[model samples]
Target: MIQRKIPSAEEAEKLKALGLAVINKEAEAVAALAGRINGNFAQACCHMLACEGRIVVTGMGKSGHIGGKIAATLASTGSPAFFVHPGEANHGDLGMITGKDVVLAMSNSGETAELLTILPIIKRLGVPLIALTGNPASNLAREADVHIDISVAHEACPLNLAPTSSTTATLAMGDALAVALLEARGFTELDFARSHPGGSLGRRLLLHISDIMHTGSEVPVVREQAQLRDALIEMTNKGLGMTAVVDARGRLTGIYTDGDLRRTLDREIDIHGCRVRDVMHTGCKTATPDMLAAQALQIMQENKINALLIVDRQQRLTGAINMHDLLRAGVV
Candidate 1:
């Protein structure tokens, strides 16, 4: 094992101070970007919005890394975008770009050799070129149809040689573009969920009660005229810690739960002789099959319940779900 040496008090304080300095410098760089979101930024957005095809993002070095993330953000937020390495674009990767696409090039110096090498080809394709660069006066920016200035006063690096504050500023600029486009397109949470179905937010927004609930024979249920013992057996067999009490027409009249059992025991009631209707609680909270699992979770939490009945609009029990079911479904 490679053990790390613990820093001394003075060293630790110095390390913390250095970290804080980096954060403050990067924050200031990002804050400065607000001023850069002017006519040129709007022009860039307009071009991207009008594009019928994808946003082809190309960059070199650290800017390339930032461009990849920007592409992903744009792709997930209603704008179709993908990252293409500038160096690779010079090889055979230029074929990936189409005449219908918009090219977004990132270069801190506005003169990355690899990116500049492909500028003529991009122009030949007759695509709108949006350049994000620190040097607005440089060649790439001058050639671009719209130039976004991501310039930072200073880098967070002590030597001012590494890409730190500049990268942070660039990333912030990318996020600003993506969010503006999202709002302009009227993108909703459902749209975001559809794009990210494998994530937690997608699980919360897209999972429905009908998708996870115990249905038909799996639902713990009993007739209103059934004995309390029968309801208990149903609850035990279904393992939902509760049972639905229904009428002869199969419409839910009430619910019988462990809490009700406790109350019946407190009253010294005869469990074998008592009817389910005599002890069940009426108007128990119920959910529709189309209700979001996230909504079901909220209802259970607010009512301090561990299970819920799924019913049709006519109050007929269709399914049931317990806290465990929600937990298993990753909605909890």
Candidate 2:
């Protein structure tokens, strides 16, 4: 078997130092982001926001990889966006773009032949082009509607051949553009959640109280004058560990929970004689049907309670939700 040689302490230290130097270079490149946030960046955001169509991102090789990530960020953050390989444009994928769309083209040198081949078609279609390039004087930058210069003083590689700092800078610029557009459009967290419905954020933002609450016969409710024994029975039958106490006119007055039962037992109150209104907790927090389930979870956490009753504007008990419901629905 071939033996592997271990690096000496001096060589190991040199490797670590090199890695740190690379990180510093990338950090400096990202720091330069503030200076690039000028009129050009603002114009890019405005073009994207005013476009009635999708933002089509195109690039080649390493730039393409960064472009794809930028497109994903834009799409998830409320801007409609997608990536198309510049090489595929002449192969019929060009139909994906239209006059209403905004094209974001990325290239460090900005003279990639495949991208240059599609510029005429993009211009003829009246689609605005935004170029992210290291060479501001490059043809791609000159022909575009907006140019985001992502030039770096040097590559992280010692030889300045590999795309290290340049790629990092390009990715940072893409993130900057996405965030700028997100703010310009007043995009909210809820909007981001809607686009990411398969993720946890989607479940928290989209799931509302009405979607996972118990209603009708599933709701554990009892008249305020009902005995503690009756309320306990309703709680048991509904399996929510709690019951809503309403007045004779069907308006919510208070709630009785397992904790309330323990407190009553401590007081030595007779379950058969004590009315629900006498033992139940009044002003128990309630939620509206349209309230986000995550918001309801926050209320439960802040109040240190396990259940929440849902009421209409008229204070009529419409539904009930508990910790278990929020847990099962992934709202917690």
Candidate 3:
């Protein structure tokens, strides 16, 4: 093997120019395709919406990589889809194609031998073909039921050999298709959360305060007439750092926390015999069981409180929430 000489600054500048050229060319292609969104695009979206089976995406080489990404985006955004490599299709992957499935085949030149090899078989299976190609007259485009013209004047590569501009155009078109179908299908945030239940959005959208709040006997509560010592015991036993002071009707009257206890102790108040109502803070902050955990976190931060009593419209104690509960629920 022999060593090659490095290019001078002028040569490097020429190479950089080629990269910028590719970006510019692809940008123009995307703009042109966006302008061409008319009846054909609408028809493509309508066909996909009416599809009963998953969309089968197929491509070769760089197109295959983009195809896989497009399939993933479709699957995550309410449309059922998956990628099947053209090369694999010839070797029994063809069984993945069903008559009800819609096929999205990508090819810059519209004549990839591997992809073309299975085109006839896909047609025989009666699967509707949607072609993304640079040449509308190419075999793939001509045979497709709907042709999305992704033709670009030239690639950004100086050698014009690498698939740069064409691949970018294809990816943008894939995004456009996915978003169009997403809107047409009226996909809601809750629907998206269901598909991504393992993510943070799912946690926020699906979690409710009642799902995590301490309820029943675990709730720290004492009557307004209860002694301060009894309230302290309730707080310590519940471990929620706060206790609700309610009336005989179980209606929330006030609240006592460790902070209030410290303030009372500093004043030398008699905890053993003093009523909880005398030492507790009146009109304490509260939340409802139906409130979102995220909203509860906001309330705690705004009021600088560590815990909140869950109450009904009648001010009766229903449950309780703490900062730790919000943290565990990912609301913070």
Candidate 4:
């Protein structure tokens, strides 16, 4: 069901220019928000922070899409929030709104019938309403305890009928509110990670070296005094591209990696006769059990090495971590 119409060089250039103009228009609309961040904006943040319950976001059509995204950002950052379609509120969703909850209504014209219809239901509960709209004199904005000016000079659409610039302005205002509340609540990166547990962000913040490191029998370890052949056998058996070389007391001495073995091969050394201590890298990189996996990655990157060892305060070898393990754990 797809058809292709290839454009000539000039036609393609014109299309690119048109896209850039739309971006520039929207960017200008967002930039103008600096002047509109007035006292009412601060009041809006205070209202949400003081709420004992959640922030209920309601909007219609294109405004509803932006509201959904705003609600998600607020929930993940720190504030409790969710989007309720304005059209659904009158049916049965009105039961979800309570006195403790605060309502954030979005409408470019500030005259959405579906949203206005729910005003009485919210009013009976005495819930505070904050409006993000273009017209301050409109009913939704007038009824709101705090009115945010999301007015835009024009839409990005060539015909000026679409909701491009206004939606962008509303989204920016929502982000500003979320960030202000996040700072007020002193929400940390760890809190954000807990809310977003399924993504790479969660892996980077919560994962520790102990969580993904190869431990116990999986550790490729050999004594420094052991023959280089023994070290090579351990490395080959474990297949970590490296082996930790320790002393008899299990204290780390050095590391023997594929790179180290390659350098020794040029000398035509006897693997069986040479001690691991003779060729092992004494100044190799190591990580601790308590360090974040991301921090371990930094060490490997900064030192320009793939394999890292974990040791205690006494330098006893406890675990081994390689770039591959980090990749598998989604920490890389």
Best by lDDT: 1
Query: Residues 71-100, candidate 2, lDDT per residue (tens digit)?
Result: 999999888999999898889999999889
Q: Give the least accurate 10-residue stretch of model 1, judged by summed lDDT.
A: 244-253
Instruction: Judge candidate 1 at residue 108 and give its lDDT.
Output: 92
Alpha carbon deviation, residue 157, candidate 4 (Å): 2.5
Give the per-residue lDDT digits (tens) of candidate 4, residues 287-328. Answer: 899999999999999989998999999999999999999999
TM-score for candidate 4: 0.92
Score candidate 3 by TM-score against the native.
0.82
lDDT of 1 at 312: 97
- The lowest-lDDT stretch of 10 consecutive residues in candidate 4 is 90-99
Better of 1 and 3 by lDDT: 1
- lDDT for model 3: 0.90
Ordered from best to worst TM-score, the candidate numbers read 1, 4, 2, 3
Which model, 1 or 2, shows the larger TM-score? 1
Can you give the TM-score per candidate against the true fold?
0.97, 0.89, 0.82, 0.92
Ranking by lDDT: 1, 4, 2, 3
**In model 1, which runs have C-alpha deviations exceeding 4 angstroms?**
1-3
What local lDDT score does residue 281 receive in model 3, on the 0 to 100 scale?
97
